[model samples]
Target: MAHFDASRMLSFDLETTSADPMEARIVTSALVSIDGAQTDMLEMLADPGIEIPEEAARIHGITTEKARAEGQPHDEVLAETVRRIKKAWEEGFALVVYNAPFDLTVLRQLTGSFTVTGPVYDPYTVDNIKDRYRKGRRTLTDVSKHYGVTLDNAHEATSDAIAAARIAWKQVNKVYPDLKAMSTDELMEFQAVGYYDNQENRRKYFESRGRDGSSVNTSWPMQD
Candidate 1:
């Protein structure tokens, strides 16, 4: 039962062309590593080989014109992103993702072989479980503000990745220190189970209201 080393972490985030991971095309991607005082980031932008929607461009500030001029080849960026994520997992670093399912599922769909065998630390899931009764929305922005983690550039991949890592690090070490003592596998199960239960409860609530609860798949850390 290896324990999660909160002192060291690797996080991934992506700014894309759409909201749905299934339909999104990567516009920017980041793999950030945080160890003690040192932080390193591998950030990349892709041309996406398609038009960037106005809404998405507004969110991430990656215009179609800008991406086409400066971004790398779509295939190259996608493959390299997956390669580095797998490599980081091989190096015993827990993957820190704000919303694990969105970015990871995008990578999974984009690179067919995008998969991991190591522990994953999803702050989004952790925050939802840890503060299940919190009133406001649990978006990255909301959680960042609630935790007092700075998110100056809300939609950028690198900034979002770093913010997520800091938020989780703080949560485990400061807010809910008991989580720091859980085994690596235990931590994974905690998020997995918590997310599943939360989603199931939400589904029941929606169903009770006579709404379609099936739209939101209850799969944790992945869409399907």
Candidate 2:
């Protein structure tokens, strides 16, 4: 986590429809810039192109009717989101997603649905959630509580994004003492091990997700 300079990073979070990326809907997104101390927020009520299950709305608070009224066309929003993400990457910033796998998976699905073509952003390229585990917390809420970071309107894109950045800062600074001394790759590896709750539980999660635990080899990762 400390291997990379915080100034070169961007923390991002997404509020989506479901846990399954292939079937998820990215309702809103946000990014926090570490370099300039600025935050960029992009939120929308996404037209899921299907019914919004009541269970899903309970989590994100975006209903199907609300989305249909205020949300941008699905294809247009997808392209813009992809373009902005790429633009940020080109500017020498790596995206820091909480659950990189989930967010990136949903991003990939959204792009495909829109028929947008190009390389999808690999979230592992900039995940800090793994690093936060050094403190013995796993879920975002626990990390937030441990670090005194308020979710700020919770479920909202910008607030969650900002919270992710704050959590990363607190966790990384604890390990390296100097945020400027670490390499990006080193930081990522540190985060991977740091965030693991326990070797056994971690392995179980991967096995359940159908992941080989090296790289994500299957979409389901594992079955419940």
TM-scores for candidates 1 onward, in order: 0.97, 0.71
lDDT of 1 by residue, 17-48 (tens): 99999989999999998777888899999999
Off by over 4 Å in 1: none
Local distance difference test, per candidate? 0.89, 0.59
> Distance (Å) between predicted and true CA of 126, model 1?
0.5
Clashes of 2: 12
Cα lDDT of candidate 2 equals 0.59
Off by over 4 Å in 2: 1-3, 112-137, 175-180, 190-201, 204-224
Task: Please list the Cα RMSD from the true structure of every candidate, rounded to 1 decimal place.
Answer: 1.1, 5.9
